[model samples]
Target: MTKALKASGFLGLATMMAVGLHQFVILSGGNPVPPWMIGGHAHLGVLSILAIVMGFAVPALGVTGQLRTAVTVLYIAGQWGIPGIVWLGEGFGLTFLMPTGFLWGLALIASMLIMFYVTITGDGDAGDRGPTATAPADD
Candidate 1:
């Protein structure tokens, strides 16, 4: 979990750098930047921070292995892959990756679902019971 959090934080820093680079490109060029590039850059910058926070929170969520893996993959895609695809597409003026937008959307949705489930279910502590429930005491 600690490693995951560190990884997320590093990604967030990288995303911030990307955003700065995007701004530099726009400001340095007389030509206008594309709206998709701007939007993608902004979203990635914000979502990267969210990913880091989520990474820190997820360990307490007690998610199953499969669900944890899903969350990690989807979060990474949302935080990194979407913006990267946009950067490449815009840089090369290629539309081949446009269809991947759907995948990015799915990744966002999956991450949200995992968070919602964890929040609602008390961090996946299945063995935990309320005050009215008690475990047997060892003598």
Candidate 2:
């Protein structure tokens, strides 16, 4: 799962670079930046970073087997799906694609809630102190 997340992160970064270059070209040609490009760039950059960070944090969450796999897959899908849908819907005038993107958004939200529930409920290895933080020593 860690490797998959890392791989997706790198792939997303690469895609972002291409989008950036495209934007630069458009701007250099004296045209206004399209709203879709801006939206795509923001989603791609932010979600890519989250995916990479979550790669490390997942193991600490104590979720295992199918639950872990489901979360990972859903997150990665949203990381790519949101931006891809934006490009398709707004960039190419495929308005129908826009609504489908909400499905991906829901997937991301679901994954986040699951992890949050696990962490707060002490159901995972994170324990009371949470994943990376340590409790203060007694006086």
Candidate 3:
């Protein structure tokens, strides 16, 4: 979980860099962004950062096993898939990619809801607060 979270953070950083690259592409071409593309780019950038933050929290939040796996898959797919779809659609002229982005968007929301549940309920190894923290008495 820890490793996965950290990797997600790095991926987020990469996404951020890509966002800047996107801006450069526009500027270099001197092309004004169409209204549709603006929202897709903005959402992709923000969600990428959110994924980075969530990656850190996943370990601290202590969600494990299947729940962790499910959330991770859904979150990663949605978070990464949107930008990918947009890139394919806009950059490669794949009009079919737009609908797939919406599906990924749904996955993103599902993952977020699961994350919220884990956070609010505080499930899993509640006592495992790193090496320094003492375990509670079984009695």
* Candidates sorted by lDDT, best first: 2, 3, 1
Task: Give per-model TM-scores.
Answer: 0.70, 0.85, 0.72
Task: Record all residue pairs in model 3 with backbone atoms less than 3 Å apart, i.e. clashing.
Answer: none
Model 3 accuracy (lDDT, Cα) = 0.74
**How much lDDT does each candidate structure score?**
0.71, 0.86, 0.74
RMSD of 3: 6.0
The TM-score, computed over Cα atoms with residue i paired to residue i, of candidate 2 is: 0.85
Q: Candidate 3 residues 52-130, lDDT tens each? A: 7777676677778888887788887887788778777876689777789888989888888887898788856653568
Kindly list the per-residue Cα lDDT of model 1 for residues 1-139, writing each as its tens digit: 4356458757767867777787778879877767767767777777777777777656655565777777887887777767767776765677798678778878978877986886787644543544534588998
Tens digits of per-residue lDDT for model 2, 1-139: 8789888998898889888998999999999999999999989999999999878777776777887898899999899999999999999999888998999999899889877876787554453455567778999
Best by TM-score: 2
The full ranking of all candidates by TM-score, starting with the best, is 2, 3, 1
Q: lDDT of model 3 at residue 30?
A: 92
